[model samples]
Target: MRDDEFLAERFEAHRGQLRAVARRMLGSAAEAEDAVQEAWVRMSRSDTTHVDNLGGWLTTVVGRVCLDMLRSRRSRAEQPLEPEAPVPAAVPDPEQDVLLADSVGSALLVVLDTLTPAERLAFVLHDLFAVPYDGIADVIGKSPAATRQLASRARRRVRGARSADSDHVTPARRRELVDAFLAAAREGDFEGLLDVLDPDVVVRTEAGVTTGASAVAKGAATYSRHMVGVPVPALVDGATGIALLRDGRVERTLAFTFVHDRISVIDITTDRERAARLKITLL
Candidate 1:
């Protein structure tokens, strides 16, 4: 094979692993693909004759690309973008998507989103992918010690956010809070809804993010007036949540994040296709 063709083959060999790293770092399949492609482009333009480990080189390239994307994403006020239009023959496989979601867990992704770009890169590369601190430090432009600290902070935040063992709130308590929220929503009891929500709760939907307990509660009350489905308790992505069923089919899902007995986050999924991919178990 020609030298260029040989290089392409080598890059292809590491594509899957690079894409996996980007997916976790960016939390979006489309963005992950873009980052991997950018890495391939950079590799093609550079001379890797002395590079001993091509896989590690490609990983660092993809990591840098994803870090840049994350920083840019934050500069834009960290708004979640609308779902990309489907590309011909490029639509993600439902099974693969589910597997990826299961591997990382949607709740973990939400928590990761709260991390800074450097902290995220440090945590994801070192903790999730087992990259060395020295290599990860090079990617984020930090010393190995600083990079380790970033990962440590991110680790504590992740554990505090998702690990049931780290938090005082038990699973049963979470279920009770979600049940109360659902009941209040269904009954248009605004004050009851406020009782279960944190003062600074955040609600995220396809439309946009709504913050503050009063604002979220108002929206919930309005939704109840025109609601058409039966909202039942369910474990959404392994987190206590509710699923709205219409005609025996799930129509929407509400995933909750509780902090000290009050719901701090409410992620609402209204897209049927996306909702179908969530690992939900009815309670």
Candidate 2:
């Protein structure tokens, strides 16, 4: 294959993930597509013989492009783009991904939206991509320590926002207990489900939206009682069923998070007014 063909193939294979990353940063699919395409164009112009990690290089380029886009988009006074779109409610696999869909989850993306463009760019490059602070300083125009500080600050914000939604609980282990609890709930073994609870376990919903453990208790019992239960609808796979009440079967996409083996949060989205371009199923 020709050099251009090789580049095109690589670009095609990674474009979806790249677009998703850019979209999370810019909050617009259109701009994300543009950023990725621009990255492709820029990469295509470079000699590939010396490029190291294609994923890293492409991710860096896209991150920079997204940062530039955000800078340009502001000053126009458009209503903040509605929080980043949630990952699709259902995906090809489930067993593999029990925790949050991706680090770029809707909640994380929302928190990212609150970041200054410099902070977002710095955080994504160094923290998410493992780009060195020196490398990131070049991208965001900050010194290494400043870059470090920026990412640390960004993480604190992310951690704080997450605390509001799901606490400091390990997202993966939380998925496990949630899965077991849902299964026990389905079996109508209230004792089995109760075994997982810590008594003080507090289930949460979309940050400030709190649900009584009682509701998760009753709802799980009923869901176990009826409907062919599939964990709340979401694109992430193999989840223990976070946000259990979000109703995934009827809606095409939904998401719930579990805390301490009990349903804690539900974040199923139903708005479609701006999503006309994406083929989404509410079922």
lDDT of 2 by residue, 1-283 (tens): 9967877998887776687567656666677778988998898888767777777678778888887776665444232454445433123346424333555563354344445677777766665446788877887887999989878766655554455454455656665665667577778777666666543233322222223345456655776676443544223333323322234323222344444344444443323322222233221
Using lDDT as the measure, the top candidate is 1
lDDT of each: 0.79, 0.57
- TM-score for candidate 2, please give it: 0.50
| Clashing residue pairs in candidate 1 (N, C-alpha, C atoms within 3 angstroms) | none
Residue 36, candidate 1: Cα error in Å is: 0.5
| Cα error of candidate 1 at position 118, Å | 0.7
Model 1, span 14-125: residue lDDT tens:
8878877877777677888899999999999999999999999999999999889987876654644323322211234677555444446532454345556788789878
Off by over 4 Å in 1: 79-103, 106-108, 164-283
